[model samples]
Structures are given as C-alpha cells and as structure tokens.
Target chain A: MSSPVNPDFLILAVQFVVAFAIAIVSLVGYRMFGSRTLFRMALSFFLIGGGILVQDAGNIATELAGFGPELSILGLVLEALGYFVLAISHIYTVRSEVGAEVSSMTLLLPFFAAAVQPSTALVLEGVARSVSFFLLLYILSENIIFLVKNRNAEALLPIVGFALLLASLFIRLFFVLPTETSDLVDLLKLAGFLILSGPVLVLLVRLRGGPP
Target chain B: MMIVSDILKVVKEEGSKGEGARISSLLRKANLPYNRLTEITDRMVSNGLLEVTPQERGSIYRITPKGEEVLDSLIKFEEFAKAFGLRL
Candidate 1:
C-alpha cells in the first residue's frame, strides 16, 4: 500500500518554489543592473530555497529511510544564513562600512548557536534560528525607515511582508503553539513570501511582451 | 539602464534593412557625450547586444535580437522597481 502524503510537504514545497523563482529573477536582475543589492537578494533567495529543500529532504528521509533530524538542522542553519545575507548585504550596500556589524555577528552568533545542541547540526541550527530572528528584526527596521523617508505606498507591501516574517520567526523561535495554530503560522509566513514576490511577479508578466 | 535601453531603442529605430545607424547619428539622437556613447556602444557590442559594422572614419551600430530582448527586459525591470518604490 502507498503511504499517506504529508500535508506539510505541500506548504514547504510551495515556499521552495516561490523562493527559487525569486532567486532566478534576482540573478537576472543582478546581471542586468550590476548592483550589489540585487546580488545579495539573489544569494539570499537561493539560500532560502536551499534551506527549504534540505528541510523537506530530512522529513522525507526520516519517514522513508529512518534517518535522523541532522539534515533538518542543517536546513535551519541555511535558513538563518539566508536571512543574515539579506540583512548584512543591504546594510553594506547602503552604508559601505560594515566592519562593526560583521565583528559583532561573528562573536555573537556562535554563542547563540551553542545554547541548545547535543550535536553539531543542532548547535548550528540554534545559531541559525537566533541569527534569523535578529537579522529579520534589523531588516524590518530598515524597511520601515525607507517607508518613512519615501512615503511610497508601494513600499508598504514589503514592509508588512517583512514584519509578518519577523513575527512568524519570533513565534517559531520562542513559543510552541498547538498544531492548528502552527498551520496558521505557516500561512502567515506564506503570505509574507507572496507579498515580497509581488514586484517580480508583475515584472514577469510585463516581460511577456517581448519577442520569444 | 534607461540610458542603455534608450541607446538600444535608437539603434533599433534608425538601423534597419542592414543599413545600421552611423555613430554620428547615434551621438546626435541618443544625446550622450562622445566618450560615454562609444564606451556604452563598445560594451554593448562586446556583450552582443549591438552589432558594429565598419564605415569610413567610424562604425555603424545595430541592435541584435539579444539587445532587443535585454532592452525589453530592462524596461520591464525599471517599471517593476518603480512599482515597488525601489531605486535601481
């Protein structure tokens, strides 16, 4: 008999698809614009996709092959790295002086990661979670400042999206909600991803006017 | 990006039937300084976004199909960024 499907897989897979599409567009945008911000965006999205892929793989392997959660931990590590890449690169691009930030991240992330872990993977995952939470907060603030200065209505979409992502991360990192509530959190994160994908989605549609 | 797209648009508009647009005409219409124009065109040529044909004292430029695609993509990209209130 065929085994039952994991409903969670569908959500995670959709996340991976969205993240991968963004990564591809960012890669094209980076090539076209030759901008550091675009490069950072592409790299971060790729990392997000990687994290999702690894996390999904771990789940499947555990169910089918009876493997451990090490792979999932690695996914968390990658997810955290992705979030940091976006935050740090944005700061470096805009400010051009990133030494202090780098030094602090280097010193602090390891300690944070060490807080709860029996193995290397778990340690890395812990660090990753901490890094994701803090970096997301940092990025969200930057978006808010941009919105304040520009007062551009369109900018609010990303701001709201980033805020939702931060909230979801906060909940995931701190609180263990019930199963039904966890699904709601997943939907919240998915909505955030969709909002951030807005610009690229429109671009893709506009790009269709060109000759094939 | 807009400037580059403008250059491509000019070449595509003026260059047709294999005649190609002369450097002088491109310079006049594109409104870019001589050095900047040549630099941009040369890069475009190297990138295969524009084709250069030799003429007396200078070369004519024509936008390739790739150039058209890039121009279209860049235009869409600019609009996309603007929609998000992002500066490219």
Candidate 2:
C-alpha cells in the first residue's frame, strides 16, 4: 500500500514557497536600488529563506531515511543566525558609531549553547527567533510613531504589514492552536510577507525604467 | 555624512517648480557647497538621475523621471530607517 502523505510536509512546502518568493523580491530590489540598506535586507531574507529550506530538507531526510536529529538542530541554528544577521542589519542602519569590535565568543555563544545542550536546542532557537521578532516590533513601533508625528501617509502599508507579522509571532509564542489549524499561523506569516513585498516590487518596477 | 537619498531629495524639491533650478539655487536649497554640489550633480547626471541644460546665465539642473523614481525609493528608505529609529 502507498504511504499517506504527511500534512506537515505540505505545510512546509507552502512555507518554503512563500519564503523563497520574499527572498527573490528582496534580492531584486537590492540589485535595482543599489543601496546598503537594501543589500542588508536582501541578505536577511535570503538567509532566512535558506534556513527554512534547510529545515525542510532535514525533515524529509529524517522521515524518509531515519537520519539523526543533528540535521534538524543545525537547521534551527541556521535560522537563528539568520535572525541575528537581521538584527545586525538594523543596528548597522541606525547606529552611527558601529565598531568592528565584535567578539568571537559572542558570535559562538548560540552554537555553543545549542551544542552543549542538544535537547534544549529547540528552545534556544525559539528564544533567538523571539529576540528577532521583538527587535522588529520595536523598530516598527518607532517608525509608526515617527510617521504619525510627521503625518506621512506612506506609513500605512508598512504599518499594516508589520502589524500582521507581530500578531503572528505573538500567536506563535503564546497560544497553541489546534493541530489541524496550526497552519493558520503560517498563512498569516505569508500574508504579512506578501504585504511587505508589494511596495518593494512597485519600487523595483519604477527603478527599472532608469539607467542601471 | 550626506546620503544619496538626501541629495536626491534636494534635487527633486528644486525641480518640483518645473522651471529647473540653477546651480546657485540648488546649492542654496541643498545646503551643499559649490564643489560638493557640482560633484554630486555630475555623478547624478551620469547616473541618469538628473539632466543638465546649459543656458546663457548658468547651467540648469532638472530631475529626470529616473531621478523621481529614485526619490520615491528614498522616501521608502526613509520610512524603513525610521522604523529603526534612524533619521535618513
């Protein structure tokens, strides 16, 4: 008899497709705009998407080939690193006195923490993801206030986009949805990214008319 | 440091009057010295972000369509920066 298809795999496939789309849009915008901010945003999306792909691959391997759990942990680590890179990008853009004094130990702390306690790797990964989400929320909130104070209408799009993302993250962190409805969170995340992608793509279309 | 976005803003605002701005007016509005404005405008012209018209009095600078597009992008960039509490 043929084996039943795993629903988790289907959900993962959807996530991969959405994440890849976001990464492509970000990268294209970066290439068209040629700005350091766009470059960092592109890198952040690419790394995050790549991390998801790695996790999906690990899941398939484990389910089909009985692979060890290390691959899964490694995937989580990659995702965490992607989030960290995103936070760093925000810091680079906002801070004027950025120093090249990053410590090796600081870089390795997450990996070491995961390695020393493999069982808690998932928790550690969750913590890292939460940190990124919180940072994003803080940034978005600040921007929303500034836009409000300045009376800029352009703020609406990003405000809606980031709000959806923040809601999704909040749901993921605090509430456990029923197993059958869990994919709702992923769908919400996808919607948030789609919202964010729209403006970037519009900008890309405008930029393409100009000299490269 | 003055970013390209800020420079583009000055050009776009100056060109908004539709008559095209003179070099002196651009320098005054952009808060850039003569040398810096000249250099930036030259680069912008080469990048297709600005167009230059030589007149009997002096050179006139106007923002091209591409320049407007860049200004739009810069506005978005400013929004992005503000999200991080940075003023661009």
Q: Summarize candidate 2's per-residue lDDT along B52-79 as a digit string, tens digits.
A: 9999999987888998887776665555
Per-residue lDDT tens digits of candidate 1, residues A1-212?
Answer: 21426666777787888889878887898897675556777798899889988988887877788884888877877877787777665565345356746643653464455565565665566566777778778777767776677676666777787788888888877887999999888888888888888777767767776432
The TM-score of chain B in candidate 2 is: 0.84
Q: Which stretches of candidate 1 lie over 4 Å from their true place?
A: A1-4, A97-124, A210-212, B1-72, B78-88
What are the runs in model 2 whose C-alpha is more than 4 Å off? A1-7, A97-178, A181-191, A198-212, B1-9, B12-18, B53-58, B64-88
| All candidates: TM-score | 0.69, 0.69
Model 1 clash tally, residue pairs: 1
Please list all clashing residue pairs in model 2, or write none if there are none. Answer: none
CA lDDT, every model vs. true structure: 0.75, 0.63
Clashing pairs in 1: A113-A127
Q: Which 10 successive residues of model 1 chain B have the least lDDT summed?
A: B79-88
Model 1 error, position A122 (Å) = 5.6
Model 1 interface root-mean-square deviation: 4.4
